[model samples]
Target: MSTVLTHVTDELQSIFDRARSVAVLTGAGISAESGVPTFRGGGDSEIWTWRGRPVTELSSAELIATDPQLVWEWFDYRRGMLTSVEPNAGHRALAEWERRFEDFTLVTQNIDDLHRAAGSLNVLELHGNIWRARCLRCASTFEARESPLEENPPRCLACNGPARPDVVLFGELLPDGVFERAEEAAARADLFFVIGTSAVVYPAAGLPITAKRRGARIIEVNPEMTDISFIADVTLLGKAGELLPQFLKERG
Candidate 1:
């Protein structure tokens, strides 16, 4: 290992050895490492190009209420692409780390179910999963093996209202209880890691700051610098898949 890697590994090792509570915040970058495309990178553009318009223009409750089929088709198209990818090594490393810490929490902004697919049990999904859909009327959620309803949006089994992907869309708030738990985890963390996130998205962006304020040592594990990199006690710059396993294995 290089001198830089050795120094960072020792620093992280010291913290992990002593930490009783640890929290990780992940974003689209992490998922992208495992073949998931960035927003506006590919998948998102296709969704927009499908109708010769932007998804942002139609990604609201009003749009869902007005033209549910259009919204469902967009999500269905994305889900179809998702079925072809699998979790990468970074995901597996985090899953293993979850077992190493009794109080470890993994908070992610990704709507993909890749973390769960990688065997992470205690994930706090800030954005709801794409593989699941929620009823707009009855508020019941169901899983879709393959785009639950394709040509037309499905109706709630109970109330017969429109069912939509359970994600936090353009105008919707995050699912209940997710932010609360994430905030609490941040506040009490002995060690906090912001992994693969750009850290620009608000409310979610406030989490690492919350951890910093509460005295948790911050380590950022991203291949590139983010808005929050200036605040990190240690920023190990590289892909989470390449850096994380090495960070864990070589840290002394």
Candidate 2:
């Protein structure tokens, strides 16, 4: 991955200098750099397996409704693991980027709060945070700082009803008003960056494509080539932790 072509680098600098608003989209790869497991791929978490089958199937609304205890157990295990991990270089750099630019928008597909933990402000979470739970009856949110609840499938104290992790699960729609803001940011950005995402996931995937079509200069940073690589004006092929800091030093 030694091909850091000069012409592409120069174009990126030009875009950075002139762009009025910038939008960034991050995926599982960024958090993976911080040792957070990617649910579906090679870096998938070991805790997601139950009786030799992946517990990921339980991360849906139907499962939560039918077997709430199982769902809570899975989420509790994940949250415990998240508490031990720290934000990596990529997360730190993006946090710094948020400070440098005035009209910057960050949209992430990850459910972990690593971006916030890294000191990034005003981030839009396409998938809700794993550290939070929402009450179905009361429509209130609670943050869990400790480990799993003593009661499997914690209840909402207010309504004494069922509560589940705030994340958008399988066959569930994204939370109200998040995707709209992401779309608005993508459409309005003068510079759009697709970082660490495969560009295959929908709604979120469409943001970069929307930005590209709207005339924003697209810059992609990933260790491997992604679907959006072909459309990027500068495809910096490397890990986000390695490439982002270098890119900032050279062109931030």
What is the TM-score of candidate 1? Answer: 0.89
Q: Whole-model Cα lDDT per candidate? A: 0.80, 0.82
Candidate 2 lDDT for residue 213: 91
Model 2 lDDT tens row, 1-252? 123332346556666767789999999989998888877654545255655656667788788778877888888878888888999899998899888788899999999999999999889999999888888789788875568576666677678777888899887999999999999999999899888888797889899889989988888888777778778877777788887766467643
| lDDT of candidate 1 over 65-90, digit per residue (tens) | 78878888888777877888999999
**Candidate 2 residue 249 C-alpha distance from true site, Å:** 2.0
Best by TM-score: 2
Worst 10 residues of 2 by lDDT: 1-10
Query: Model 2, 80: alpha-carbon shift in Å?
Result: 1.5
Error of 1 at 172 (Å): 1.8
- Which 10 successive residues of model 1 have the least lDDT summed? 1-10
Q: What C-alpha lDDT, on a 0 to 100 scale, does residue 19 get in candidate 2?
A: 73
